[model samples]
Target chain A: MESNQNENKLYILFFLVLSVILLFLSSQMSWLRNYISYVYTNTSHDQVVNGRQVKNYFTLFSEIIEIKNENEKLRDENSTLKSQLDTISFLIEENTQLKKSERFLAKKSKYSEVNMFMGEGLEIGYIDLGSDNGVKKGGVVQYGQYYVGFIDSLDRSSGTVKLPYNRSSFIQVSVIKPTNIEGLNTDQLKRLVSEKTKSKAVAIGKGDWVSVENISTDKGVADGDFVITNDPKIGSYLVLGRIKDLDRDPASSSITSSIEISVNYYDLNRYIIEIQ
Target chain B: MSEVIITIFGIFLMPILSPFFYGFLGINVTALFSLLVLRYSHNLWVYITIFILSLLNDVTFHLLFGSTFISIYVSYIFDIIIKRVIPNETRTLDLIFTTISFFLFYVSLEIFMNLSSGSGFRAFENFQELASSLLYSFIMSSVLLLISMFRTYFSGGTGHKIIKL
Candidate 1:
């Protein structure tokens, strides 16, 4: 009788121990909880293993079918976007050549050729191409026809091109209009025009931007006037943006104003960088 | 000479063996293999041996230090608890308890690291993976238990009896 009672006691202890273990495991292992949840939700379920949770085996097959259908839909959308981008790039290159010929006919100075090399990834993207390559600091960088940024740091093999849209980039520019004005000396106007051509400016923010400061407003600057870098080294005018804001200080002897300039970094794949 | 040879072999072999590589087969199976291969006589000695082994495992593999220590300690706790409750330990109990204990140990460690680092840890991400790991450990531990039983049976004569408690 005592041995039988002890056997019964041992069985009870075994059950208690197993229950405690399962409780502990369920709390700790998310998989165990998921299995329990799956089992509880599927009332007719019997066994739950790692790979196959068989709820009468029929339902498991249905779940696999649904997942395969979703996968096919994502792949089709990915291919469509890639084709559209390819067509857009081809048109932009053709248009830039036409504009280049128009500028040459107008007797405007030619844009400088800026070579750009794509890097592996962002982490080590700043590796320079080579020492022999003419890439230098303060040289402008562009993606396609639109201005991207400038070379901030360079090594023997690579350089870090600081994007104009990057929070840190800033440059000085001047606004120019279509009609030439009187009383502005030809040399002084030329100097101002040259300076406005490829000069540097700091990036304050990004959006559809216009107008920039540190340029004289008394030169008959208006809302639609074109601003470009004022650096004399880069002789050609790179269209920045249009003036959206103009605040003239009337009391000051020297005219000081703020003008918005235009350059959309996102619209182009390549940039026209000016070597300084 | 045998003891020295075993000790030297353990020292040479441990760093080369990795839980990650073994965990591909299953975390539990790898863990059970580690426990069986590194088994010692005394409880204190077992804990210390496992701790050192785990540390060596961590350093060689470039894993987070003390991870193996946490795993081993949790297993040791479960071993003690099972030994106390089931005086005559069955193979099934051993398998179930070790699997549960190992699972809990990994889950707790992951949770603690995630909370402390403020990022979610990805040790065993899915339910299927966890289930496989548990099964692997159970099977491996059972194999080890069977081997141990066989060794005992062969080593003793007909007059010798197996200890129940």
Candidate 2:
């Protein structure tokens, strides 16, 4: 028995040493982790591992069908609107109002599911697409034309997206006067963003939403105005969100407002984006 | 049957569960489960199971490899020390030892992963985050352990009596 105990100790020691070596090796071998992650991703299937219950939205088949119908209706409406706007060939100079920006064309794109969210405010999210998919850092992530986030970091097969609401996210944006975009169709708004805008304010991420500050009162910035990313690279084609919580203080020279990210992109299963 | 349950939840389910634990919940349920196993069994397979779980954990979360594995071993070392000093026979002693082991586990994990981080590593650089995470997990796991122990006590024995096999 004493001999067996010693033998057991040696076996444990050997196993531990082997594990430590393998651990070091795993860091160097990225594909190993990627392969394993793929296995886990398939198994978890959007299960909330947070130990907290996530409400199942599709408990009933009717709910799923209803959502599908709503989606179909939106797609149809979008197509009609596109056709209605196609007659007016867009005339605005696309670069007139933009800051001197990164001038790369987004020739490639991909779709990814959000793996999970992390960080202090739970604003940082990891998506399944990674460097492997030609996803570069600073890649703009969008849901169609609406700006959502930027790629913060990446592993072999996954990338972290810094949501616009993350404290670390600050995007340069121009506040479009409410009148500029009020009745304009998607194409018209896209054109309007390219022209010189009334107010240029820095959108500072403020947890669940962003706050655009330092806009002069004369700029006619209102609660319903459009906030679009005015970055030097990747011009203002994508809408950041819309202005809300319009704070106008008489004592202050500038006005501040919160930009409401209209859609809860978090609820979307897949993120499809054209990244430059 | 209990071994089967532990094998399923402790090894298979933990990799799926750990990211949620480590991400915002600030706990390592894998470590918690491993602690329970170590608290009861010195079987070689227990260590191997934890090692596999940690590996799967790092893979799933895209964390630094072996970070979780090494951290658990560090906790195991603490457990060994405490096992000697504290008679873990009573319920209170058991809880006390487990808590201390968990605290050391997180500390080791934080320090180990961050040090191995090519960036500078000061063990205490992010002390507040670590403490808050520890507090959160500790309270939660303590409640869980307490409930299990109570239920088992009523069932005529300990929650996990040392299985000699």
Candidate 3:
């Protein structure tokens, strides 16, 4: 019995030593680590890992058909709006004087539209762009005029966009408190924040919704304010969501007293990745 | 065969549940695997499996090298000793041991990570985050233990051998 106990101890010692060696080797070897991550991501079907339902090809095909119909309707509306906009461009440009500004004239970032929805989670989707297309790891993704997601991971052929609703997705954002106007236009709001005080806060993803945290209650952040990304790489004050409510009291004496706000994003299919 | 299946299941399940316990920083659910191995598997295979799973977790989550591996291995050894001392491991004993071992795993791993991180390690800044994460983890572990106890009672003590064999 004593001999058996001694052997067990020896076995444990050997395993422990082996594990330490493996750990050291793994840390040093980037290829080994990358391969493991690649395999894990590949094997991990989207919605399955995130507890979202996996849709069959038939359901997907039907959804595609529905989207196609909606696209045509939007296309007709866009064309009609474009003709009307052309007639009023001179008047609008004269009023805002934004057309003269280089910042206003230049596009903030290049976009890669949604190619496919990959994986189990609705938030984790795939785009057609790759490293060759300059799609980077931290590149911001957008849906229409709103900030939605960022590039989670990517390879040579494809990339993953972690939507605003993902649990680990954290983005720095600043709330827009309209001072002089009831509802300011995007251009006006951008110029205002850029010219004046732009205090940034962090927003964390929570599945279907988002929550802004670490915001000092003393910042005078109120309800119905708009949240926009502070990512310089994106270089645009694209609205992310509206602040539905506040968590902390502005009257609280505690220095650690911080407020949280709810965030909502557009549906997954409308997302576009900003590539450089 | 059964052990391999269970270990694989655990590796897949732990990461999914971990983000829920996450506070300012992520909660250390790799400790849960260590706890599971301690409670079950009298042999060395479970420990070995846990080591591999912990390695996979560290790599996937971009944790520091040997941080989680060493912390969990130490916790496994700690649990072994605790099991011996508290021979009749009741629900209360299980909760107590889990809190002790979980905190042990967290502190040891965090220290190791901080040490490895060099200038990036902010001890005072991270203290609140770690504390909040620890509290959340404790609550989650308590709920899990309660569920296990309930399952054992409902199954007519068949599940009671979770700590023994």
Q: Is candidate 2 or candidate 3 better by lDDT?
A: 2
Model 1 Cα lDDT, one tens digit per residue, A1-276: 787557645643454354345334433555543553453423212111311332336566777787777777767777777777776765577466435533332123233443354443221124334344656666655433233456678776657776433445455555566433223332445565655433233223332232255444345655666555544433333444555555667764333333343333333333344332
Q: Candidate 2 vs candidate 3: which has greater TM-score?
A: 2
Candidate 2: residue A32 lDDT (0-100): 77
CA displacement after TM-score superposition, residue B64 of candidate 2 (Å) = 3.1
Of the candidates shown, which would achieve the greatest TM-score relative to the real structure?
Answer: 2
Model 3 off-target regions past 4 Å?
Answer: A1-11, A41-276, B1-4, B11-26, B86-90, B120-124, B154-165
In model 3, how large is the Cα lDDT of residue B43?
48
Worst ten-residue run, lDDT, model 2 chain A?
A96-105
- What Cα-based lDDT does every candidate model obtain? 0.48, 0.66, 0.62
DockQ of each: 0.02, 0.17, 0.09
Give the alpha carbon lDDT tens digit for every residue of B73-126 in model 3. 666777789889987887777877777777777766666666556645433246
**How displaced is residue A188 in candidate 3, in Å?**
62
- Among all windows of 10 consecutive residues in model 1 chain A, the one with the lowest summed lDDT is A43-52
